[model samples]
Target chain A: MTDTPSQLPAHDEASIRVDLQLVADQIKADSRVLDVGCGDGMLLAHLRDTKHVDGRGLELSMARVSSAVREGLAVIQGDLEADLKHYPADAFDYVILSQTLQATHNPKEVLEGLLRLGTHAVVSFPNFGHWKVRLALLLTGRMPSTPTLPESWYDTENIHLCTIKDFLSLVDELGVTIEAGFALDGNGQKRSYKATGWLANLFSEQALFVLRH
Target chain B: MSVLDTSSDNALAPRLTLEGPLVLQSGVSLSPVTIAYQTYGTLNAEKSNAILVCHALTGDQYVAGAHPVSGRDGWWHHVVGPGKVIDTDRYFVIGTNVLGGCMGSTGPKEINPETERPYGLLFPVITIRDMVQAQARLLDQLGIEKLFCVTGGSMGALQTLEWAHRFPERVTAAVPIAGSYRHSAQNIAFDEVGRQAIMADPEWRQGNYLEEGTVPTRGLAVARMAAHITYLSEPALQRKFGRRLQDRENLTYGFDADFQVESYLRHQGSTFVDRFDANSYLYISRAMDYFDLAEENGGNLADAFKDTPVRFCLISISSDWLFPTSESRAIVHALNANAAKVSFVEVESDKGHDAFLLDEPEFHDTLKGFLDGAARTVGLDDGAQGESA
Candidate 1:
């Protein structure tokens, strides 16, 4: 997600990624949500339209933040690493970090901040351990790059990229309960396989987890 | 022309004097208070689309049309015109000269009825809340029970916040851009310097310059020069002027406007004195310094808006060190603590505090979105949407 140029989709929220839409589906109506690294606020807008959710966003890029705010979403220009600490504990019903976990400076601390700020935390990230990425790395003898993670290694912002297994281990260490999870393939289609275990990490192009303290 | 004219038949700026004396926050009663204002667009049958636009320190009632004194276009014409962000075609817009303003309002420059002379230093010290109180009187006279929105920037933003705090039920929504709940220490210091500059001039004559048959032009110019610097960012200055020479290539050792920056500052100062009153500057700046909403609410910012139903959209400029984004965030935190409906946007701009007045597309978009959203909740007709640039 970090490797892809940050292009805002059309105003139609249906054009948002399938994983983000799935995340939106889990949220109940009228709940307060905080979208970290919310980009142009597609999911927040969608949730506001569908769920009547009171949504707020924290986006690192001012350009994206400006666009989000233009679309009537409550967004502030902020860094996920530094700005998350300012939000009061349990200020939100749900905090969604969609496809932005890999680009954070400290994914664990960011996760801790998310859990602290919201009653439930939804996190999505590209799976670095996918079969295609592994095959490319083994055959090319270099860092793997796939369509989902398209940037050259030197220019990529995915400094802390991880797989489903890596994220599950961190969740276990933090002692949080995973309420729900979803796996998606390379075509941005949700896979019905159990979101955990070895096969999910190797084959799923991306993963989504709903965790609570 | 009498400054306290109670007649409402004036063609240019409409004037109205309140029915009774308005007791000031400083405990001084000001009788026959007058407010000069300009109105644009129709108020509609339901009268629910009224937006009260408060002007900043140096701003006046000219929100959209050309300014009478300066003959230049209104300061916020970019955002307040027919098809602009404020969109006069859709909403009823009213801009007023603040209580302590020099533009056809009862300020230090206005003549005192008791002494038949300019009030000057005799004008009672005012606060942001007091300014809003005067506006409320104006609204009462206009028969407007509730305002759809109240919006402003800089000192105007302070007034916007004051409107929401003092009369929560009267305001449907508010947009405070590049403002703070209280004046920061640095802000007070900068305003103090300007006041001192005005007082230091011999011609000022203890705020009696009007009686002395001479204006404190030099002092007012110097003060304007100092205050104008705070309105811009260092990056904007560097990009616009840098180390470039003015007019001549070689540097003149004799302090004759050697740099383009110096020339620019001088022009800003000189042009300012022609249209503003020095004593009015002192009164307005002092009012701003005394503004502290949190302190007024017993030092708990959240208490200022407890259980208030007003919606808010706060905006700050990224490069505005004078007001800063942190000030806006503090407001957001307080609103959150109170569980008030609020949204905040820190616009990325190199233009600094004055970005609120500049052509920042993002700022306009955010304002349009907030206003449009608020309009929906208030049951106002959307009408024809304005063309976005």
Candidate 2:
């Protein structure tokens, strides 16, 4: 549950991952990076610890900010909607908002803010149109609960949820230039997001998008 | 400049404040000031261990000596003892009354050179940065290359942070416990209320009340009593006194110290008036308000330390609601942003922000760890653990 004796462990299935190898490969070594919803500032810290990358982070939870800070990471206590403007234009080479877009008050506006502050924006979210959630909604009809969306409808902060296809349409509609796309299956391994186009939206558990403003 | 004896300077009866060209916050200058101070320990070979120990509100330079002016006990007896955290036996600890401070540093009590009278409200406002700049000059005149460490709490911490940011290279290390990069608006507002109270006093006489033996005791006392509330936590206050009545029975039904809390605050206020300069309080608090480290760095507190090589150990008490732990975390965040060598430990204490001065084992341990680590990093000549446990 925890990596170290003095560490706050991941409380749920969602937590920091060593799979930041993929995220680190996409950015320049010295480029400035900002990570939104940067839990324990894992990817940014990895980028900093190895790549000499200067990183900034925005996290809402006080405990997470303290944890990230204790690890010597520059994390700010901020909500995405309220604090995005504090960063100047093109302040970073990449603004990575992984696992946070779906929970924002205005995902499009946040994307725009991130784009304005960074040249490249990387967004990752659990694809709500995945087959299990669809089948759950179709069969049980209780707002769909799965391991991905563990919280009940009342406790969950995940609003404005979307599927891979819906997000792709969002990018196109918002004139966002998609640089790349990756999909993850139930086991949390990366694969092509284009396979069985119909099932990709209904079954691909997570989608990672790399886009330009 | 030959390495003339600093003792010669000290031997000249040590004119603490030569009071030159001290421009106030509102663009006026004060001169011919007096500074109350006390020196401890001795200057070593490189004159490098000149550690300045600043004090918070109500603290005088008698860091290790009886106050010559106020006749009060040394404020930090626990930390300034022979084998204490600040060990006067090895480290030359110099504590000076802040500019615009009571007890000696020129304030409402000092006479204005131009008018040949005390400059009460006419005393220009001062700032924490200004105080630091003045100290830097003093250190330069003393032929000290760099300070081993600048340590303080509360207002003292404010001054220490100013020293680090202002003379980053000169300060080898800094211990700004329970201080913020900028005063919170709430604190600023509190100080403003205190100033207004002093001004609103009937005997204030537009800052010339001293001529008539008119001191704004009531207003100043009220201000002190109010600010005293902020320096402690509800838990500390509650735990100490806890609605217990002072001296008499339950309901006196009059404006008196019916409760212990009331009596305690009154004592703090009255005693404050005895040794503190009311106008100096105004100036020092104003200085704290103007201390915004980020503003000087073009709104990025992190950029202020970008090129500096100073290591920092910021300690904050968790029970200190005044500065709080978040303020310390803010500074840590800034230091980390610049990738500077730094450590932060929010010592768990119920003694409020004043834990820096108390005999808290945890605080000492944290300081020992940081200091030992920093000394090893900088290759300072360490001889055992000097007696301080």
Q: Superposing all C-alpha atoms, what RMSD in Å does each candidate have to the true structure? A: 3.9, 7.8
Model 1 chain B is weakest, by summed lDDT over 10 consecutive residues, at: B1-10
Report the backbone clash tally of model 1: 0
Clashing pairs in 1: none
lDDT of 1 at A124: 84
TM-score of chain B of each: 0.96, 0.91
lDDT of 2 by residue, B118-150 (tens): 777777777887677667766666677798889
- Measured by C-alpha RMSD in angstroms, how accurate is candidate 2? 7.8
DockQ of each: 0.37, 0.05
Error of 2 at A103 (Å): 0.9
TM-score against native, each model: 0.88, 0.68
Q: Which stretches of candidate 2 lie over 4 Å from their true place?
A: A1-16, A19-21, A192-203, B1-96, B103-129, B139-220, B230-242, B285-389
Tens digits of per-residue lDDT, candidate 1, B178-269, equal 99999999999999999999999898999998877778888888999999999999999999999999999898789799999999999998
Compared with the true structure, what per-residue lDDT tens digits does model 1 show for residues A71-101?
Answer: 7777766677876765678888999988888
